[model samples]
Target: MSTVLIVQFIALAVSVLSFGVALWLYTWVKSQPSKNSRVETIAELIRRGANTFLRREYVVLAKFAGVAAILILLFIPHPIWTGGALDNILMAVAYLVGTAFSALAGKVGIQVATIANKKTAVAAQQGIKPAFLAGFRGGAVMGMAVVGSSLLGVTLLFMLTQDATTLLGFSFGASSLALFAKAGGGIFTKTADISADLTGKVELGIPEDDPRNPAVIADNVGDNVGDVAGMGADLFDSNVASMAAALVMAMSLDNGTPGKNVLTVFLYAALGLLASILGVGTAKMGRGGSPTRALNSSTYVTTAVYAAITALATWQLNLEWRIWGAAVIGLLVGTIIGLATDYFTDDTKPPVRHVAKASQSGPAFTILSGVSYGFLSVLPAMVGIAVASFASYLITAPLGAGYAMFGIAMSAVGMLSIVGMIISNDAYGPIVDNGRGLVEMCDLGDTALEITDSLDSAGNTVKAVTKGFAIAAAGLTVIALLGAFIAEVNEAIVTRGLNIELLTGFDIMQPDVFFGLLVGAAIPAVFSAMLILGVDRNAQRMVTEIHRQFKEIPGLKEGKAGVTPEYDKCIDIATTGSLKELLPAGALAIISTLVVGFVGGVHAIGGFLTGNIVSGLLLALFMSNSGGLWDNSKKYVESGHNGGRGSDAHKSAVVGDTVGDPFKDTAGPSINTQITVVSLISSLMASLFLTFSLF
Candidate 1:
């Protein structure tokens, strides 16, 4: 068999292995004991609420995906009447499959996470080791599923179709789903989180996760939907988009055949997944090991293993060292970005400590300090992305024409190479956050509280780092997509027999390119505002509901034995409000890309993607880091650093964290998906844009 065929089989084998591991992890987590009747009942309520939100979200997403698939069938890659009917049919099916796979992975995360939260809390009574193992292993299920399905789906689709254009259809489908899932989930989460914090912690000075607070259950449910499911979908979309972009370019450079370059891409991606699986397997906490240290160490192991294995593979396969170097640069930069983000967001770091100190004065200083540190935190990640792109280009440009761009694509693939590990780390955050809440409200014990609290703090810090890592990867991924757009446009130019000059690159001096550039820059800001505003609007309603519950229900606030806050009511408010607000913001991102493509054609799109990526990366990093900083600062105060819980400093820190709720969780992470969606949409619609633009 040819190397490509061998690699394809190997990829499939690796994918299957990941699924096996995920199954084992699931079974293992389910076996963990949680016999507390109260914990069980509350966990059931959380699980039900989370599943309800996901079911409703999927119902709405199904309609969107349905409409999108039909459109892809009719127009994408070509019009139906122009032939390639088989390709169109497969594209639509593949698109739907992509959505289904992404949705399934997310559903799996919710299922395991809800169960694991109870297990982790109960196990914490045994000590941090068992609790940590339960939480980490539960998250690893999602990590494995996401990367495994992405690898399998891409492999099978490519093996069957042998058309890169079809992969774009699949990617666009993933992106479309991810965009809405992230937005809607973010809205749902922030609404409940902000309401619970303000009403319970700030207004009434009640403990967080207090059963007397109606929004507490909704808040816990949001952790699953928004953080676990939504973030899983987001990373899933990024991994697929990066691969699709690289494969599209790899095919052209290989003269549309399964050449050495093509084999290299498959091999590298497969190896990356294998490394993450090992990393997850080897993750262990010491008797009193810092959860942050344990999590960071696993990521380091994954990174080292990927680098070592890829290097050996390159030598054995006789692949170009230049390309391997480019990939490694991307990998190294990704690690640096994560570490830098940890610095800005981690509680042990000066930035977070300073932010906590600022809260000593009041909430105003808290906001100002967080915003400043957030903006400052953007520099390292941005610089890292730029360096990765430029260095990868420089190292591989000598290989041949188009190789430079492929190098950047490979860089993206390499940067996200350990995404299985990244997602494990990322998902660990929310699961443990939920564990902390469950432990607190279930009255598990003060020991359980201490363990989950430390784990939750680590989760918050690591989630921010991973968000930065993801956005940086998207930065390179979208740039590669821009290059793919050019490849598609030129291919279309040849097929249509048009006498136009094929685009090499967009010139910003042209008015059309500059117009798209300016418009694209504004889109992320507008998108962020809409999402944050959605949270603002929904939180107000939920807050009013929270107020009504406390005011109307007898002795609910006083923690009377028979009094229970109506948790289901707040859940309904979040579920209903989120679904209503999800579509508009995502529609704007996709629609703007279409408008730019039609109004100014391919050149405009090239510039538009550029502008959108730059703006989106900066905004995403700032919001994620700053929000994380504020969150950790609050934890710091609550830990009795600046001041103990219920102090003026604690209240001010709570305000800071509250303002940051939508910033990091809602808009920041979603923008990464938003930009990827725009890039994929542009590539899918490139032929139409080439043929029909008035300009």
Candidate 2:
């Protein structure tokens, strides 16, 4: 075993152990009897009532899960598990089957739990069974179905892309970029939803730290454990697995010998898994009361990994200065992007009376700081891409280094906070609105719910979604330009022995072709927006139906009928907030499509758009759903803490006082893997497509 492999194994084992310990402590705490930490005064009671709730199961389950994961790690055998075209095909098939089964199983379990919770809660309230209790089961089942279908779709996509590139003469470069672009769009959409849920809905109705707030408990568990830990596992399992598989394939092609650098793949896999855990853990630990702590840890972990990997790759691969150069360039690019965002971002603070104070150079300094930070963020990603692409060139057989570079470049862009923020916003949207609706229902003594400050989260989600679209636009544009250049070179090389007339009509910018590419670019956003609208509408309808049914209950007859204006407004804000954003997003997409198509050709643009959409959607769905799960779990805990009974006055008073669950859901889930996946998947697809297209 290589030294690197040994180190990786050790790290993975430690991660598992640490996760186990954390879970054990959490469960231990929960198993104990509830302690009444005194409410010192009336204010204290009000505060304590809201802030004390936390799901005790997270720690317990996490520990067991962690330990289990470690044990599972041992099963990953030595030697390259996947090599050659046949091996990749089989690996893709396995991933597809595994993800499908997992999704189905998870969905069923969730539904059963939801059903049980609703049924038991209602049965205690009334002598008769509650209809909504059954609704929980249906919803859970439906959720799982959605997840399964989505995963199946993605897995199939990966299969097709790989097959097309290797077996069929499809360009790896084209397919990969298209997937990433699509995934980017989806990630942005889902992230925006999450943000809306946290800031607008959750913050307005219930604070993250409020133990009495069911929303609080839900956010804690749903966003923290589900999003952070679950995502950690999922991302590591899927993306890292795919990457490792791809790396093995690429290296085999380059080396012309299957055995060369076999240990590197294993080592990287271990590192990737560990990194995944830390990436998620940092975010989870930051929520409720420790935002900065979680964020800082995440930053540190990512930085350390990036630095270590770059150093090792450079030394082992004998890539000379390219490694450091790539890292530096990445950092610089990231910083520039950050600076631009900071500068362009309009000051959201209310108009101040002191114009001089407002005009202070603080904005400029902030821009500079953001730029510098952006550079830091960009370096790791850039270096990763650089190493992967450049290393391909040194091998006797080329594995399409150019396409690898393209993917890496896109991945680097994903590291930026702008991408992270956009993702966070989408994931939080639904949760926030749900909280607001719940609070409003309680306050008005009506079936109708009212909510204020509920649109903030929605707006944030929209903002993030828009920003992500813009980023995708930019990424697609770059890929297209690069692809066009590659095509030109390929045409020259391939045409040497053939009659030039056979390839003479190869116009890169066919109008009909370009049009299709443009359409594809816009498709992901449209699909995501429609999905969000559909899901939210369904949720609203269900909640409304539940409210109506509650009115039929004898004791619940105190509430009035119909939806309130506030609730209506909240819905409008959440649904339509991104509409205007769509216009700009569309424009950017169009511009990117045109630029790339014009420069490279219709095929390149199409590939770029396709890859982006696929990757974006996958990332978005992962973050949004996972975060929602976390939010729900946290709510369950808070519900139990609030004397296992609903309390409105207490939930409302402290709801406005708490900062949202930004750390666990947004900074953690939305920011890290969701964003990273967009780039990673795209790059892998691009490289694979390049090889296929060449043949």
Candidate 3:
């Protein structure tokens, strides 16, 4: 067998091993103690509500995917009547497989997370160590499943078809699922979160996660859908897109050795997965250790391991050393970006404290301070992405024609090499967050609540860091995808017997390109606004339902025995409203990309994608960091830094957190998927645009 086949088989083996580890972690989490009846009851309610939302969400997504598949069959890459039917069929099948694998990863995450919440709550009664382990392990299941499935799917699909275009179809499938999963799940989560906070904390003066709040169950369920399932799909999309983009560029390289670039990507990705598995295995906190420290340490360990292994592989395989350096550059920049995000969002940092101090004056000051910090926070990440892309391109430009772009793709892979660990840390936030809520609702002692609170706080900090990292990775991946788009367009022009010389890159001097650039820059802003507004509208409806329950349900506020507020009603409302609101926002993104492509052809689409990446990365970092800063500020205030809970400062901080919720959760993360979807769509439809356009 060729060395390429050997490397592919090795990647497949590692993927299978990762999946096995996920299964083992799931069983281990299940084995943890969960004997409390009240905890069981509440956990079951959260589980059922989460599952119900997912079921309905998937049904709607199925219809969307169906229509999208039909279109792909008819028009993508080529017209069906042009004797490209088999390839189109393969592309459609690959697309469906992408959606199915992404959905399955999310489903697995939700199942394990719901079970782990109850386990973590029960373990919290023992001490912080066990509770931390339960939450971290539960989240690890998602981390492993996502990375494993993404790697396995990409490798297997490529092995079967050996076609980079088909891989683009698979990546598009993942992007489509991510769009709905992230947006729909975001709306569902924030709607429940805002309604629960508004009525339960602001109006009633009750504590958070109070049993009397009708929306409390929905709130817990939202954590699973939004943070666990939604985030899993987001990262899955990024991971798949990174691999597909790299493979596409590698296929176009004029290197003397065939398959060298392809094998290098596979080897790097496989090594990264191996590194993450080792990091997850070794992650542990000693007695009384800080959860934050433990999480950060594990991330550092993964980065180190990935660097060492990939360096060794580069030496052994005789690959381009500059490309390896580019990957390291990406990894280091990712770490730097994460640290910058932590500085803005961590409670131990000045940004959160500054926001908390500003809250003493009023909500306006809180908003002003948080927004300013949010904007400032964008600088580091933006610089990091720009530096990584530029440095990688420079590092590999001397090698050959297309190697520079391939190096940038490698950098994205390097940055996301430890995504398995990042997902674990990110998912841990929601699991422990749910643990805190469960501890309160089940009436666990103050000791248990305190322990879970600390764990949850660490989860939040790590989550902020991971969100920054994920966005940066996606930004780099889409940049790589843009390169792939150019290559695809050139290849189509050649295959169709056109006499035109193959184009190398987009020219900013073109009028149509400039026009598309201007319009594309506005897309992220409008898309974000639509999502945030949907949250606003849906939250109002759920808040009204909460008010009605309090007024109509006799003795619910008084905690009358045997009288429960209608929790199911609130869950249903969030479910219905989220699905309703997500469609238009998704449609807007898809339709806009098509309109630009049809109007101005590939050059315009090129300009459009560049504008989208620039603005999308800016808004995503700003929103995510600002929202996290506000959240940590609220927590800092509640911890007695600026007067304890219920103080004027606390109230003001709550308002900031409320505003930041949708910014971080719904709109910020969803933009990453929107950019990827547009890039892939442009690549897949390059032929049509190249052959026929008004401009």
lDDT, candidates in the order shown? 0.93, 0.31, 0.93
Off by over 4 Å in 2: 1-92, 97-238, 241-249, 252-269, 272-290, 316-508, 557-695
Candidate 2's residue-wise lDDT over 355-441, tens digit each?
Answer: 112112333332233233323333333333334334322331233444343233323222321222222222223322322332332
On residues 567-626, what C-alpha lDDT tens digit does candidate 3 reach at each position?
Answer: 999999999999999999888888998899889988899899999999999999999999
Candidate 1's C-alpha runs over 4 A off are none
Minimal lDDT window, size 10, model 2: 349-358
Q: Quote each prediction's TM-score.
A: 0.99, 0.43, 0.99
- Residue pair clashes in candidate 1: none
lDDT of 1 at 174: 84
True lDDT of residue 378, candidate 2:
34
Identify the runs in model 3 with alpha carbons over 4 angstroms from their true place. 254-258
